[model samples]
Target chain A: MNLPRKEWAAALCALPASEVKHLANVLSGELEVRDVALPHAGLGLLNLRDGAFEESYFIGEIPVARAEVIVRSAGGMEERGGALIVDDRAQFARSIAILDAVMAGKLPGSVPAMTLVQRGMEVRQQKQIERKKLLTATRVDFSLLGQEDDEDEE
Target chain B: MSYVAIKGGKAAIDGAASASEYLRSKGSLDEPLTLAMIEEQLRLLTSRVVSEGGLYHPRLAALALKQFQGDTLEAAFALRAYRSTKPRLLESPVQDTANMRCIRRISSAFKEVPGGQYLGATYDYALRLLQLDLANEDPAAFKAVAKSFLRDTPETELPDNFPKVIDSLRAEGLLPPVAPSRAAAFDITRDPLVFPVPRSAALATMARAETGGLLAMAYSNMRGYGDVHPTVAELRVGYLPVMLPHPVTGELMEAGEVLVTECEVVAMYEGTNGDELPTFTLGYGACFGHNEVKAISMAILDRALQKGMQDGPTNPSEDPEFVLLHVDGVDSMGFASHYKMPHYVTFQSDMDRLRTTQQKMQQKESEATT
Candidate 1:
């Protein structure tokens, strides 16, 4: 409740797909959501412009999923939240909307929602570190160039 | 000449399909080709598919590659076909390439750029010799070597953004001032291309064009067919962020990042706008992947087309209609292969005309002999 509902929604939306799915499963029993707007999938255009901003162009379209839901808290308070996710996962979009509504209502389960997001962030960071290590190992070493040059000269 | 029309042969067509599928699966049944391997190992191929298909989904591109059995053109075609099925949503905000998280940046015009040139994952200096040991090498050993290489390389910190070379040129008044485009981007997929099409539409067409076709046209220009001798002012391979305006707050939010290859070509163009001073004009090319040759060729073609606009187009590359129409692999492929279809009636008509001409010539020869 202390944190802005928008920030909470952003955090929830930012979580990895697996983490979001896990969180949804964890919180599905605790919250009740009525569909304000049914989840739908559509395409969003990626507009590109020239260097001088001379003209805008549609490069291509990307799949977008959107949903809106109204959450009814145990305390008899209701809040509506809208979600616009940038993929074709209609279920994920629906879950995100529910999470947003729950955050907006400041329900008792909001504490778990925040903690789940934090956990997801930590996991993502750890994965990023591992990936960096792997990529660093593959870096081409230019230092052994002198040795190769000497061999070529002989 | 005799010709007969036959009914449908659905069973034969079905058998042919089964045979092709069987051939694809026969050899690789023991160890199947995984999508991850295709994505990682054949990265350049996958990138080309993504770029030419005008789609950014790696998984879909990988699936396309699998379905097409590593045929790059076919994979690109498949991806494009898949793209046609999807719906258009909203236009993303203009992405600033100057702020791209650059992995590789180089300039051929200048010996050095503001941030030093970093040649990341390039084959420019690599020896072209085939590695014979790869044929019999253990897969686990290969993985181990790759892992060790990644572990040993020292990490160097790079700046978050790199300065554009053209911007510096503009500051020094070396480049010509660009007029703002009258319209927003033209969607090549939806709108029919009118001749003397906007530069944006032409560029969009080239972005998804067959790399080989673009290269041949550009190569001809570089070899003295057209009037564009360009220096690579900047070639950058990096991730460009895709930002979308938030539905709720109406502020730009980072949706994702797409790996793109961008090239800025510096060329001398005689000004047609009554300006006596010849100014350095820029030709720009950017595509969905790290295809350097495609980007460079596209940039040269972009410049070559500009010359045609000022003076009447003298070369094929300079003609927008000629260049754009032939570059699409799908269109070219479909038309080229259409000859495989049954043309029995036309063939018989041609044969009858040839026989009539031969009989008349024989009759004339007999009369002369008599």
Candidate 2:
């Protein structure tokens, strides 16, 4: 069985909903989308390793959106697409899954879909870079804490 | 504990529900708090709900707070209800604190640590005076102040991660060696907690414990009820990345991150075996969102519980069952509020017993006097 992919869908999710919707609209015209099952928008259980014991256990639940689609082109080519995100929009997941199928199958409107995916990737990358810069700025250099050898005693 | 079911309160209950909605809107003074406002502006409060609720969805936590009019316990209960309806997807890959993208890191054990102490966003030293100007804060001024700070701060590329303070101590053989355990992971949501639960279960319980409830128990230990006086090894507040396996390919994929606070406390050391070198006992605490007090208190209690479990419990904090069963916000709140429910039969029976005893006492006194 062919697999439904997620990386592209994740990148697409980073873009604004309107942008994803626009691309999805352009490609969806030539596609017949069928839900492998109904999209799921609910909790995803978060587990963590206990620091002391180092054993894993349930910590909390995070909001999640998951969707799977079988897109059949007008010419009868089929491709499977799926996405699971730690967000709470089933509709967005469905739209991105459709886009994922378009990009993967290289179906009609694939170029525009690829462009949108690139934009989303760039957005995610920029956000990460900015976060890293701010976090690094706060790093401490404790060597500056001690008095210099030539300093006068108080 | 029997309950006499009361009928005919549906209409009154409906009226009360509608009245609550009206009061909530009125209490806002017509300036509704948006979910983003609640999530960002009311961060600590929202964080408390997220921690106590044991759910990492900040937006839903904000929504819960909005619906409950900022009642933390009810908001947590609402989160619990919301999560209970959802299916359990899968367990996440183990997250190591060494990889945590830290925003704040501090150590009380030593003045110098591997990662220089970064006191990122803390009010520990702030005087608890109320800011009168905040009563009518100007939004433009607020934005300007934040903008100016951001603009002025220079950015530098530094190491992506920091070393754990505990690692330095561990290398010196001062800290207890962590023996990797092969125990199966426990899900508190699914299974009934039997007595003498695993250390992981206890940790999970404390992770979602009510801050006040955990504090009350931990505070007693701090005031000399327990022998585990601890030094803070490390306390970190940061975002830990979440990774899940791809549904199809079975390869791990990053699934965003969750904000968390983690703490490790070192307690007094005792020899494990004859002629063996004594090492410091360690306790660990972590929870969703930023609650330093909760994390520290949990760390202390964690050490105490370890001592109790190992050498027999000398304090209530050391007792696993006592602490775990009582510290949950939802459980304690529910049990506390259950008194408001109609307990006519139980109270009436108590009254009957009391009246009978009083009548018997009167007869006995009269006979004796005669």
Candidate 3:
């Protein structure tokens, strides 16, 4: 699904915890965001469904940290950015808010912000590929011994 | 009967808290119990907390362990409580276990699979005797002995993906064809579980269930209380990638990897044909971390719950309500611990009823004597 610019920014903010933290650190030097709201921790429910794909059930709760910020572009146009982080990293959420604002405002340096997100995704994909390779080595291959037996009765 | 609330125990409660803290820190001031030690040495416990908490962060689980002073249930509770504070951003795409990076994989049904079975880091063959030498052993000596066990040369690497055991049976029509799940995945945390719970909800509940509770129910089934004889089809310990849909392109993107234990057990079932032939049905269990027993028990329970569909429920384990309601550590612990709370009003009422009955019985006895 093609996401709007703000949603895309939120997705970037929602990158894997370590990657998001790193991206935030890198972007903090490039952009300045005014606090629209203070970052805080909250809770969210995780839902589950049965094997039959029938009804939903409540599993448990998950901690979420969120932050909101406003950014002003070089042209003096301001836009709000918000982040809903999955864990309890307040600083990381704040950084996400800044990046979100930067992207939402369509700031001059937003291209670099998008590039950082792409790089983060690439790194994650590379790691996954390597992990899959190691796991694939463990797959059990079975050797068939006899000629195929076909039974037909009408 | 009357009851009054007790007040003004704040000082005593404060003192008790202080005493507990002092006791926890009394042993040593120099060398502290580190989170690293708990995460590494007590890995199974940490894994249990993570699995039960339904969160994958080992560091947070370790901290919870420290805070709870190594009470697994309480640690899990703390983790769950912490999890509730976090927000839900996006649901990860379904993980394919076939693509997992497996560190260990085994099957009891097959003597050999395409890739040889890897018995990695298991205690199955080790003697149960405790090493008394470890009580005051030097760290350097322990490291030396551990290093001695490592192989100088690496063995030939195994293949990446193995064919699922169930797939072979399905190919030959020995197993029933399973329709793909059509319902959207549900979060057990978000909704209360109702009767006839979906397999996903049951598995989710069991995944975080207390190990002993699950084991007891599973043991009952194995001991003939229920009808299931399970053979380990596949038991694997691995890391599966968590993927999310890309916001811009909508392509699935790898988010991260979570360590998990996945198990599939094959159980005997009556064939659909008119003849008295037998076929195989599958029971699956998976959870965070490398807990084989929990996973296996979960698999057993998963199959047992299915017995209700084929045969009328004859056993307690086969009842979804009985099994699911009693398995959660948090719920059980809360109920169990609540007994310690004051029951003044209820107890006073019971005492009054007993006294009245005793007075009536005594008066009748005196009249009979007169």
Candidate 4:
């Protein structure tokens, strides 16, 4: 639960490399950071259950990047923050982990990281709204088939 | 017969690849094809590559599409080849399709369902007439087009939840309940697929099988080779969120989402066990990206194969071995293309047999004449 969920983690991961790198660049100068786990991009086989037998099988591997880092604050407080996103960049993973650590420990730049999250979430929500609008526009009205009554059923 | 290995023209072979690339690139000098364009313009083609490629990386799929000069089979081959280099990190927790954020959903069997039938972004009803304007399309025009559509679109909330059509059938006791397997489902990548595969393994193979190949097998049954005439219960296309256990917390959380197409089909039920009552049998199909035809074909074939397994196959489509063995495009392409390889040794051996047989026949004829 401490880690960012799918919604915002996607945005964090999708941040332009220059922007994420800029933030991580600044943070590295301030905080004593060390990789608890080396940042690396890898593959994860997505397991899916069948509609027939509920039997699970590997559908395919999604490109992913994950990193874990221990952030040390000036007060000698330490927090381990992890970042995992659906991306294929190791550098992005490390940068996002730094952002995650800052936000988790509420470090100096926590406000800025939170700012990015809000901005990205809004962008995502706007796209979703537009998509939902299109969905509303295209919903099937089956009244032509003498099912005028059923349109109101749902 | 053993192939005679011949070596030479290494430079020419490499030059041939470059020449092919030049031919593909020649027409477009000022404007070059981008990965985004390939992914967007060739949506279905890219989806096929992702599905058949057995990988979910769209950027890489686009690259493969571009690199292979839009040869889907080669693109898929490139992806599978790329996957061999990366380390397998983790196996995701099982995902439920019921949680899909569907962009398009329809049920052929029912007129209405829990969620209203959404007819989103399909060319099914559109005319096949050429739109010549696309040849000189302005990329920036999307802003105007999207804005105009948005202005007309009435605001309505997208229902996050969509109940499965099969769920209602099972509740009504019209369909058999699916019990979870006691053992782990088969992983085809790690294990060799032997005959008499489990349902999971069969589904996995069909999921990644080539679109044309799977269609051909399914079409055989539809054209009266087999008896499994199915009505699609539901077909959905959407972004299915993948859940992975948090590495640190060990709690399940959504990792990411991938575009997928899923189909559930209902077929004629027959009494199999003496004690059990007949219920409508189910066939399920799903794949990495939005290939509706592939999904439906896979579903039909799944039902057919299950029928073949349960009661014994009467036709090729019903036979699991026949369907699975022949539906892979890469495998078929490789085997078929290998015919162009040096077959001189075999041809010579055949020629020698024919000459000897002809000489014997000639001597017998000469003796008879004399």
Per-model TM-score, in order, reads 0.87, 0.91, 0.77, 0.94
lDDT of 4: 0.83
| Candidate 3: docking tier | incorrect
TM-score for candidate 1? 0.87
Model 4, range B1-370, lDDT digits (tens) per residue?
4689778968988999999889888978678788998898788899999999898988899999998888999999899989889988777778998888888889988888878898777898999999999788797885588788888888786687588988888988888877888677777778988989988888888889999999999999999999778899999988887776655555565667899999999999877567777898888889988899999999999999998998899999999999998998788988887898889899999999999999999999999999
Candidate 1 regions exceeding 4 Å error are A1-16, A52-54, A77-80, A100-108, A115-154, B1-6, B145-150, B154-156, B269-277, B364-370
Looking at model 3, residue A101 earns an lDDT score of 68
Per-residue lDDT of model 2, residues B223-330, tens digit only = 988977888989988878676665434566655678899998888887877766899888888899989999999989989988888888888999988999999999
Q: How well is candidate 4 docked (DockQ)?
A: 0.62
lDDT of 1 by residue, B1-370 (tens): 3335667867888998899778889967477788988888888988888877777777778889988778778888887788778766566776677767666777887744676566767889889999899889898998898667556765545456678877787778788776767777778888988888888888888888888888998998999998788989888887776666545555565555677888889987556567556678778777877799998998999888877765768998888888888888777876776677677888989999999999999999999999
Judged by DockQ, which candidate is best?
A: 4
Please give the fraction of native interface contacts (Cα pairs under 8 Å between A and B) kept by each candidate: 0.36, 0.47, 0.12, 0.67
Q: Higher DockQ: candidate 1 or 4?
A: 4
For candidate 2, lDDT tens digit of each residue in A1-154?
2222445665676788888877777677767888887887877767777665466766777887777788888888888776677777888878877877776777777778887877777887666555554555565565655655635422
lDDT of 2 at B24: 84
Off by over 4 Å in 4: A1-8, A147-154, B138-143
Q: How well does model 2 score by local distance difference test?
A: 0.80
Docking verdict class for candidate 2: acceptable
